[model samples]
Every structure is written in structure tokens, then in C-alpha cells.
Target: MTFAVAMYNLYDKPISNVKVVKTIPDDFSDPVIRETTEGRGEVEDNKIVWTIDKLIPEETVLMKFTCSIMVTDITKRRTGPIEVTYKANSSFAGGLAIDKYDAYTRNKFYVDTVERDEEPGVWDCKLVFENPSEFILQLFNADVYSPEDESEKFVDIDPKDVSLLPAGAQWHSNKWRYESEELPAFRKKLEFRVMPDFQTNVNGTISISDVILEIASITGGMSYDLTQVPTYKEQDVIAKLKIINNGSAPLNEIAINQQYFTSEFNPPNASEVTMIWDGDEVDLPSNSVKFDSNVFRISLKNLRNSDTGLFMPESILEFEYPIHCVNPVKEATFESEITYLANTFPLSQELEFRPEVPIIEALHLRRKFRIGKEVIPIGALGKYQIILTLENIGTAPLQNVVLMDKVPDNFEYGSYSGGKPQITDEVGEDTLKWTIDLLNADDKVEISYEISGTGEYSPSDAQLGL
Candidate 1:
């Protein structure tokens, strides 16, 4: 496939030092470069780089590349993330900030005075200028005269010779010493200028938008007969996947690939599948939405040159369909995963998601009880060992569970494992109950207790309430 990547000078001013670095996808073959508009196109470091001297306003530069594909069952090809950089004549993408005239004059000027111990009563001094702004300073001239006598000149910097001061920098004058009993003072007059803002007559700019590709993720759960599945023997189960575009990049070339494990599930027809994004129903492209015995695919945008996508950035999309239970005779643990391919067209980049699919499963629960009764003297005394085990064998944890077991009277409760369960003695039977507050799916708990009475103890089956 051959696609055109172009850069347009949108501003009214000219731009210079243009550099474009277009990264070719790994899946595509080495690009076959075609003729460019004006700049030179070279392949360097596995990148197609195009650089131009300048671009006039409204001028566009285009480059074309032809890449072949392997044409497998389903393939994804990307063309971006392209990097374009250029400097406009007199502008910045982050907005311009030109300081006021007074701010440029923010500087400091002072004279250093040091007393000489070697020569008593003599003092040395130097004149300095400190620039605190970001512009270069031009020092014109400075004159220092003795305050005691107006005609006595101490320091003189010529006005004809201009001195340059670096930005946020300082300048110092030659040192001079004065012989006087008291601290000597001088009068000074200075002249300098601050560099002014720039002004030019340039016209035109060519700053191409750099491609920012972020892989869109589908984050939502499957909704079906989760808690109310047991209400009907056979019914149509609905599966839904929700997606929200949380990033700034719009979603395009969207397609869904879903897998079903068993043949007992009857996938809905292509026409029956419903897709909605931003409250508008989306129509699947013809001959692209396919349903197989165990898998199905819904293509929102056609695989070739999709003009529009499923949803824009900050939008929501929902894909829902019905799955008929072909056989509801046996216990079913329905599990399936749905993942989506979100891509940006033209300057194509994509993110593949492999997160676990939402599953509706019947968590494993085993409730069992064991009894050991001992009889003494053929019938006089009896002893019993009751053990109840509860195991949660699922990925998620199990909540509350109440275990109830009834034992006949005359059997005194002995030691119990973990802790003794609640005991309530009735007339002819004693209800031995254990309330398990929580049980992690990866753990198991066992309750063992011994009882001795007059006759062989028969314990009823342990029951669970969830």
C-alpha cells in the first residue's frame, strides 16, 4: 500500500530548519521511496528522514512510500509516529512572552570599596555593573569624580567605546586607590542601553503536526445473568463490552476479536449484534463482521482506508450481543475473553490488549462431613468424631457461609479443630453450627470435634447458606 505523508505551512509566516523523521512499522517491508516535493528523502537508522530549508506560507510538502505486506489472515500495519520539527520565524508553540521595557532594565550597579592595611588610610575601589535580565547589555560610558574637589577626576570610561555584558552577567572597571585620612567618596554618572525585542518582515511557516499515538484500552465488564441465572432453565444470555476513550487521541480502525470455548454456546447472527458509540448506533461494514463456531469478529471500520472510526476521544462505545445456551442440562461455567484493536488511521499506530476476558463462572464449593462413633461395652457408651471441611476453589474469594449439622443428644462435645462451633441443645437433637466469616479462594478450613454419649451417634449432612 502506498500512502502520502504531507506537511503544510499553516501560519502566515515562513518557517525554517524543517526536519521530519517518519518511522516505518516493523511489519511493513523496507519502504520504496518515491519522489518528494522539494526536500531530500534519505533512509537513515531505519527511518525515513526529510529535511527542507524553508517552507513558505500555504506551501505543502509531500512524500510517498510504497510498502508491501505479507497478506496473512489478519495483519496490522502502522505508518507513524512521525516526528516533525520546524522553527517559525517569530513565534513559539508555547505562546510568546515579551517582557515590558522596564523589566529589561532590571540591573544592579555598585562600587566596591576596600581599605588597604599595608598603606594606612588608603582605600581601593572599583565600579561594577551587574545585569540581572536575560538580554545582553551595552555599557556606554562611566565617569567617577572625587566629591571633595569637582575638578579631581578619578575614573573615566569613554562613551565612544561600547562594552558588551553577557546576559545575567557583570562587568568591572579598573581598580583605583585614594590616599585620605577619612573614607573617600566619589560621584558617578553612567550611560548604557538594554537590548530591545526583535522585529522582522518574514512571512510564512510550515510546522507539521507531530503524530501522538496512544493505544486506546477497552475497560468494562461483561453483563449477563450473573446473579439471577438460576431463575430460568434456558434463556438468552447477553454479553457486553464497554470501551471509553480516555486519552486525547481519537479511536479509529476499531475491530473486535472474541473467542468462545464450547459449542454449547450459540453466537448471535451478525445482524443481531448491536454496537453503539456516543449514543449513536454503529453499522458494521459489509462482509467484515464474521461469526464462526467458536469465535466472532466485528469490524467497525473497513480494513482498507477507513475514513471514520467507532468513537472519538472522550467518547464511549458499547458492543452487545446474545449468546443462546444450546445445552443447559449440566452445570455451566461460562468463560470468554474479548479484546479490541484500536488504531489511528493514515499515520497509523495501534495498541493490542490481552487482558483477561470477563467470565461468569460457578465458583467451586465442597461441603462434606465425616463421623467416627465408638461404642463401649457393646451399647453403654458411645464416642463420635465429627469433621466438617469447606474449601473455596476459585480465583475470587468467598464471602459468608453458614454450616449447620444436627447431632442427637447425650453426645457431649469434646475438643474442636480451629475453634468450637456454636452449640444449641434441643430436646432430642443438638444443632452444631459453624459460621465462617470469610475464606480465601486459595485456602481451606476443617472443623473436627469429638463427642461421647450412650449410643452410636448418627450425624446429619452439613449444609451451607450463602
Candidate 2:
């Protein structure tokens, strides 16, 4: 969130009145200036203003500040279009220049002559030009003469174009040889301009574009395998949590924490949990899992390593563990609430999900029935007391129950129990039926009947139906 502004002086002369202003984002806090190279910077209302009195040639002024985003969820969070206003005597930022001209100024121009002893009357001469004024100067041409009247030319200098010479600048002409009878002396004529009056006024305004910073967000859910579990028993259930990345930035260092009541459920230790990343199953490292009394927390600095994190754009991270349903005496509902928060300094997004365990209810379901058939020879042969009984012995109710028993081929119905039954077989062959609308848990029912037959007394196993 640190912002820096640099103003460079790309001119031959000093520039003045450098005022730079940058707009701060609405969600960001008031900025505090960190450092300045050659300017005084201050924070104003929703903006940072910087001012510099003057900047010498080749001088650079730098301003820096940190812009930290404190609060933001809105889509459009943008920063400044930094508008800069500066004025210089003559220069442009885009490396452009105007036509060059010259003006008059204080300058020096002369010639030096030297004679060698070996060659009689042979002299070497050169012309020198120096600018000692406070203004820039330009040189066009220079010439030298030996007779002090320019009658005989010794050296001529012309660069074909005007040469820019700044203040305190000096120039030298090429050497020329001359032959003289006496000690050589020379006069010079120079064409030059002192750059003082031909000045240009320059004004500029520059714009530095701002940038958009995206926000990071997260969302997810938790669930359990069983929705309803029968009471009076302990059961193992699988619990899973899914976290999805739905932000513009990648995420790292996740912590998943959950707490459950010990009376209703039991969370698994770290060794039993498994992790699935991006639809691929993997082992949940033991170091990442932590378990306390009734709460467990899982920590992961990243999925793979320090360099890797959540997938770019979007990815899925899942965790699963075995949880047990505590045996209960009555119907009860178990709930578990887990929290997921990204580890960020001074800023983080948290997510929560409540996954309910299976509901336990009172249930009783079992079936046990007894049937008996007895015959007693009381007085005569083939004339005996026939007895048949039906009983229901079960812990649960038997609804719409119909018990049926068939008589032998040679036997016939003579006497029956409290309720009479309809004949269901051929003539002289009948089936005894008993009907019960409802039978409570741990309840029993019994029915008896008497029959006479010519063969031995035998009855098949009873059949019960709705």
C-alpha cells in the first residue's frame, strides 16, 4: 500500500513551483508521509499534497507514503490520478527542444603564439574562447591573423553550426603553424552570442494513473453422513467439510476449528481424519491436527509448501473424519459448528457452518410368536380332545395381523375359540384364522380350538400376515 511519486528535472536550468497532488481512495485511511527527497509533503483532506521551491538541473524530488486499505467490500476501490503542475524556464518532459539562438554576454577571446628553437622564425598559434558570465553563450566562428590587422590569416575556425556553451564554459581552436622573422603575435576575430535575453517560459501538467486493488473473500459449508439414527445404540458417522476459494487472490494458511458437546457426540482424533484437495484424496498430516477435550482444530500453512497455496481463480479443499453418536435414552439432536478463518495480519475473512448430527428417536421392532397343538385320548378311540393355541410374544406391536392354521384332510371343525373363522379350503377341509388389530410392545395373544379327525393329530407351522 505504499505509494511513491518521483519528479525529475530534465532541463538545462532550474525549475520552480513543483506542486503534486494525489487523491486517496475513499476506503483507505488518511495517509502519513514516509519520506521525501527534496520536497515538503503533507496529508490534506482525502489527498496528499507535495511542494518544492526549486529544483536544480539534473535534480530529482521523491515523495512516498503508505496507503493501507482499512475497510472495503464495494467493487470499485481506486486510487489517484496524480495531477502534477510544474514550471521551468525552458524545457519539456517528452525530450523535445525548440530552435537554438544566441544573445550577448561577457566573454573572452584571444590567441597564443609559441616559437620553437630548432626551426628559426617558425611559430605555432591557437585561438581560445572562454565564457565567464552567468548566462549561456553560443559560438559560431573564430579567425586569427599574424599582422594584428587580419591582413594575413593564420587560423580559421567554423563548426558549420551554433555550439551551445553554458556558463563557466571554455573552448579551444585547432593549432596552426606560421613562419615569422620576429617574435610572433596574433589578433583574433570571433563570432559568438551570449544566451541571456532569448528565454522561454514553460508550464507543464502531468498525470499519473491510479490502480485498482482487489479484495479476498472465502465461503464454504459442513455436513454429516447420517440424518437420523435409531436410539439406544452407538453409531459411527462420517463428517465432512468443504471450503471453496471465491476471490480474486490466492489464499494460504487455513485453520479449521470446531467444538461439540460430549454428551451427544464424539469427535475423532487427528490420526483418523483425512484431507482431500482439489478432488484428490490425500493423507491428513498428523502435525496439522489438534484435539482437546471436546474441540479439535486443524491447521495448514498451505496445501503443499511455502511457495504453493490455494489454486488460482478457484479450488476446492475438503476434510473428513469419523464421529460417533453417543448412545442416548431419549430422542435428541446433535449439532456441531465449525469456523474457518484465513490467517492474515490485521485483515482476515471468517466463515462458519453448523452441521447437525443424526436425530435419535425411540424405536422398538421385533417379532416372536408361539403356536401349540395337543390331542388327548379321553375315553374312546378316534374320539379325542383336540386343542390348538396361538400366541403372540414380541417386544413391538403387530398391526393388522392374521394368524391361519389348516386342518388335516380327514378332520373337520367342531369347536373353536372366542372368534369363529371362515372356511378357506375344500369341503371337510378348513383353515382357522385369528385377527388382531393392534398389539402393544411386550404383549401376547392366545387362541384355542378343538377338532375331531380320523387320522393322527398333526398341524403345520402357523403363518402370520397383515
Candidate 3:
């Protein structure tokens, strides 16, 4: 019978010559087929030798061997295979003996490098398998690590969905699940079949040493520095700053500096000037933040009209934000258009008109009087009285105010007892007239005339024939 032997290190350190021997029945011809020793590494002659025993036909012969002889240092771990076979006899078939081996199994490995997402967050990890031989490999369980006081869970990566790289071949499954509530202080272990398939008796096991898992979480948000931008000055044109948060977490008790400033209407220069904010401080909302919310308003009562000597109002105004925000608050801007006119001119000057101080316009009679109801009886002289009220809403009093009323064609002119009567129309069109001596501010004059029925006639009748 022939013998085959293999030797290798579990930790990947290389191993040199390993001895092998086999005993056969005396009837078997002393190892026929000529070839004595063969292997992958350096081998000396007589490494595998057999002695003959002619006396005993059935006695078993022992094959002596001494093999630990390679001349290199075995610090690094390695492994290789060895095979032995017996020459086939006429009656029996040749037998092959083989054993898988490794030189080192307990060598330690470390994480060489680590990479994280540009936008901070936890991400999954991957391992590469390079071992070409079929071997058994094991990993340190996640639960075995520290901070595992909590529950543990894991999910296997689905091969159908995950893309497999070169490392995919040496694994039974492309990915496996490993999770533990405990904090990961130590490296985790992962084990797998050295060879992807068992049908082929391949040699060494390849593994990703000390695999690491990552945790995902929100770090800090964007920040704003105030020292870069200083306080705003009066009359200085400035741009607003903006703060934005697109993340899931909300900020707390945020507030911007109160000393922010923007341009305001200036009376002395008759132009838009900067106005620093000195208003009370304000706090931001818990959930929502306004993109263009107004923080403060600058009064524009100072601008005056240069040519018209009137206060010129600013209809459209632009405002800017402060340098620093409570958090890194984004600067916001807004434009306001007032409903009513604030000032008459754009130049800085004196006040031209103040409606509240009794400034009046004109004193012409707004409307004349004709006192007759819709159903004034046809011919019966419907006794009617007409009244007139004259008002002086101007800045000064009105004098020589004369009130007059014309009598309808069917009525007769009446005598005026209140004032001297002046009749301009000869056909008796004048019914009444009055002259008020004087009408002061917010003052008015009232006068009335008397009339009687003349005769009965339908409204459609052209004239009354007395």
C-alpha cells in the first residue's frame, strides 16, 4: 500500500517538509511502479524509503520516516496539500490517500482602512474572500462583543439583489446578518466555507479578518459665524443671509441677534439710508421656519420732497438680515408696499398738508334744492317748503353766501321775508333767495321758502288754465 501526507498552517504561515509512511502486507510487491517521493516543495532523496523483508511472506513491514526539514522561518502562516497512492496490483485496484492541511490557524488581522459617507451617516460594510481552497472558517459572533447587554438581530444579504464582486465566490451566501444592542468595542468574527463548493476538495480558507459594522446617525447641521460679518451701519446697503435645514431633526430655542440693520428713508439727506435694528429680541418656532418672514420694520416718515417742500414717502422698501443667527440661521429678505400714501414727495422738506389740522379745499355750492315728492297732487297747490344748507369746510370762513331756488312752472313766486329778494327771471322762476353774513370753518347756513297749491291738473297736463 502507498501513503500520502499534507501539511499547512491554520494562520497562513508557511510550513516546510512533513514526513509520511504506510505499511502493507508482505505478499504485496515492495512498492512497485518505480517512483518513490514527489511533492510541491523542496524534497530530498530517500524522504520516502521502504526496506525489504524476504523471510516473512505475510509479516507487516514498517516504513520509517523523518520529515520536519524546510530551512525557512515559519512566522507567517500558510498551508498546502499532500497526496499518497499505492501501485495497482492485478487483482486489487490502486488506493489514493489524501488529507487537507494548513500551516497556521490563529494569526490575528486588523482593519486596514475606513471610509465614511460625505454626508455623515451610518452605512453597511462588505468583506472580500480570496482563499482558493476548500476550508472551514469561523467569525467572532456580534453578541460576544461588549455592550451586548441589549437584544441582537441580523439579516442576510439577498444574493438576488446585492451585486457580487470577486469576493463573492468563496462564500456560501454573499452576505450574512449580524446585529446586537450592545455597543461594538471589539472586532467581530465571521466564518465561512474555505471553498465555495464542497464537490471540489480545494485547499486553504480565505477570510476577511476582523470585519467592522457601521452605525448611521445625524451628526451636526450647518453653522454660521458672526465674526465674519459685522453689525450693519445706517445708510449702508447690505444683502440678507439665509439659513436652511433640510434634515429630519428640528432645532430648539433659536434666535437671531437683535442688532441687524437695513436701509431706511432719511429726512436730512432726502434719500434711502441704513437703519440698524434695535427692536426686542424674538424666539423662533419649534417646527417651522419662515423663509421670508419680516423681522423688523424701519419707519420712513423722515423723507421729504425737495421741490414741492413736502414730506416724500417711501412706497417700496427693502430690508436685510443680521450677521449671526441663533443657530446658523439663514438670512431672509422681504419687500413691503404700503396701502396709503405716506408722504407727498421723494425729497426731504416741510409738511405741506395735514388733513387733521383743518385744511379745506373749495366752497362752491355742491347741490341745489327742489322739494317735491314723487306723488305731488295733480292740481291742488301742494304746500311745500324748500331748505338750503351751505357749509364752509375750507381753511377760512366764507362770506357773501347767497342761496337761491327756482319755482316750477306750475307754482307762483313767493315773497322772501328772511333776506332781500332778488329775482333774475321775469316769468316768476324765483321762489326764494338768502344771503348769509359769514360762514366760518365747519359752519353752515340754513334757509327755507313757503308755497301753496294753485289748481288741480294731471301731471301729464301741459299747463294749468285758471
Candidate 4:
């Protein structure tokens, strides 16, 4: 059978340095090179290689070769598919691109014979011929033969009559009935052959869709204490971006641009912002500059596909810098945009940034002591009253607030007021624990306890564990 391999340039621009490689099946032998359209190709060790300098847009390169199928046993005979890989360099699309194609002889034309039913002495068989190729197949002749029985003759199709089979079309033969004393087991001896017009060009269309790119950003460490307004004061702030190619085609000539505005509240230098690509430090693009010496523009490039000839689903780029803001600010914003060339078309995605402020505040714990109506004396030994206050001065509510207060060594355990406190007395010290389910903003809880001084007590001897 003669096989025609074709490579079509689906891109609009001309492709240079074209290389086509084809691998033949093991069952086929003695490949005879018939012709090539643009370049010479030869079969080397069961593989064919063709090199063309350039291929114009919409141009197709065709290579023809002939190989015969060796059938030792009809039931055990099988052939593998022909695999082809092509690569070309496009100037407009930035560097090399690759594509693969597989062609199977079985996919082109095949026949199947199955036994429908079998009675005591009769057998019914059905034969079907299928054309699965994209182009029309001109079937010259087809025949079924049974060599075991002399009564069963060979069914021959007229060679002069040509049958045109459309793409994805099937042809069924008339059911054949065989009568015998025993059931017909037509498994090993049944054989079929099909002769089709093989020198014609099999045409098909190739569609190259536009590339689709999605970009997302996540800001880290954007929280602040509610006691003061959110400020960026020599603190590290990170912006993580996830760029992905969600299209069928590869994207190239990629560039990412981010503009960071620095005012009196945020005075981050352009050099201070370090750009990391896939965990490696990379130099910024030429277009990156510090506009007006305050507004910085960060540009990155060469974000293309990997060696596997496909773009990665996600490419992470992180920008980290130290923010120096002396005064508090309501908010800070930045803008980022990604531009790339996909299928020879320019595409871009822009993202608006609004830094997030986490709802977290600093917890305050105050401890004070008094004796009767006045503050505790320096060396008083009477009963002393200890006051503990836990306040939540943040913008958000605090959950699961546990306050642990340790009593002094010389103080004796006493009853507490205002809140129920779990007291655990150890050998040397005692612990007073208070649990609050929720503490809203500006809310405070005070717990007071009276303890008698058993030994010589001083102000420095009293230590509050919070």
C-alpha cells in the first residue's frame, strides 16, 4: 500500500526551518520512497526524516512512500499507526513550535466479518467495510474467500466497477448462509482483501484557535492592627500572580507589566521590589522604569511555553518589597497587566489591585492591686485585692479568649468576683484562669480577687502572668 504523508502550515505567517519526522510500523517492510514535493526524504532504520528550509502560509508538504503488509496469519495480523512530528520556527510567533499527527492504515479502510447466528446445520455471516478517513475512498475491489471447503467459493467483486466511499461511510455485504452437517466455525480460515486507490491526496482541514490567558493576583501580609490605621512601615508585602494559558494554542512573546504607585504613605523604591519567577530571581524587562521617580513600572518577559511544546497551566510570579510608610493611609492600590502573542494575535489582561487588610488587633492585659480602699502598701501584709482587665481594642471580634493569671508565691487563694475563674493551686504557685467565648471591639472584662499575704510581701514580689 502507498502512504501519503502531508504537513500543512496552519499559521498565517511563513514558517522557517521546517523539520518533519515520520516513524513507520514494524510489520511493514521495504519502504520505497516515491516522491517528495519540496525536499528529499529517505527511510532510515524504519524512520523517515524530511528537512525543508521554509513553508509558506497555507502550503502543504507531501511525501509519498510504498510498503507492503506481511500477513503470516490472518487472525494474528496487525499493523501499528504511523506517527509524525513536525517543527518550524515562526518569526512573528517567537521561535520554534511543534505539532504531531498519527495516521493508521486501519483508520483509513477496514473490514469486519461476524457470525450472526448458528443453527444445527446452518451459519449466517455478515461482512462490513468501513471508510474512516477524511477524504473519499475509491474502492477498486474487495473479495472474501474460504479455502478450507471446495463447496464454499471465493466471492469476487468486479474490478472494472469503482465504488466511491464517502468519509465516515460504511458498506455492508449480503448475508451469506452456509449449510453443513456441523456448525461452521469460520474463525481462522476466513480471509478478506480490499484494493483501494492509494496514490491520491487525502485532504483535511487544520484549525488553530486563538490563545486564552487568565491572570490572578493574591496579596500577602495585608493586615494591620486596628489601634492605628493600616500602614506599610518597613514591612514586607508580597503580591503573588498566577498566570495561565487556558487556550488550545501556545502563547509567546509574553510580557507582564505592573505599576506600583508610591505616595507619602507608601514610599517603596523600585529596586526594593524584588521579582521572582518560578522561585528564581530574574532581571526586569527593559520597559520597566520609575516614572516621575515615584511611580514604578515593573516589566517581565520571555514567559513562553516549556520544552514539551505546551504552555503551562499556571506560571507563578511573586513580587516582594519592603513598604515604608510613616503616616497611616486608608488604602493603597496597584495595577498589573499581562500581554502576549497567541496565534499571531496580540492579547492582554489587566488586573486592578486593592490591598486587603486582615481583621486582627493586639490584645491588652492590665494588672493592678489595691489594699482595702487605697493602693497596696509597699510592705503591707493585710488582704490585697488584685484586679485584672482583658480588653479587645481591635476592629474585629476575638474568639476563644483565655486569660491565665498566676498568683504570687506568698498570696493565699481567695474567691474571685465579676467572672468565674478556675483556680488551680500548685505546690509553689496558684493559677487563676478565665475563659471568654467572644470579646467584641472596645469590650473589656475585669476580674478581682482578694488574697491574704502569708509572708513578708513587697511590690516587686508581685508578678502577674498573663
Name the top TM-score candidate.
Answer: 2
Rank all candidate structures by their lDDT, best first, as comma-separated numbers. Answer: 2, 1, 4, 3
The per-candidate count of clashes, in order, stands at 5, 1, 46, 0
The lDDT, on a scale of 0 to 1, for candidate 1 is: 0.65
Model 1 spans > 4 angstroms off: 1-253, 259-295, 299-310, 316-418, 422-428, 435-466
For model 1 the TM-score comes to: 0.33
Better of 3 and 4 by lDDT: 4
Computed on alpha carbons, the lDDT of every model, listed in order, comes to: 0.65, 0.69, 0.31, 0.51
Each candidate: RMSD:
21.7, 20.1, 38.1, 22.0
* lDDT per residue (tens digit) for residues 340-402 in model 2: 766332233333334333442334345676656565554554444445554567666568777
How well does each candidate superpose onto the true structure, as a TM-score?
0.33, 0.38, 0.17, 0.32
Better of 1 and 3 by TM-score: 1
Per-residue lDDT of 313-406 in model 3, one digit per residue for the tens? 1111222333221111123221222111122222211111111111111122333322222222333446554444566766455677666555
Candidate 2 residue 338 C-alpha distance from true site, Å:
1.3
- Between candidates 2 and 4, the TM-score winner: 2
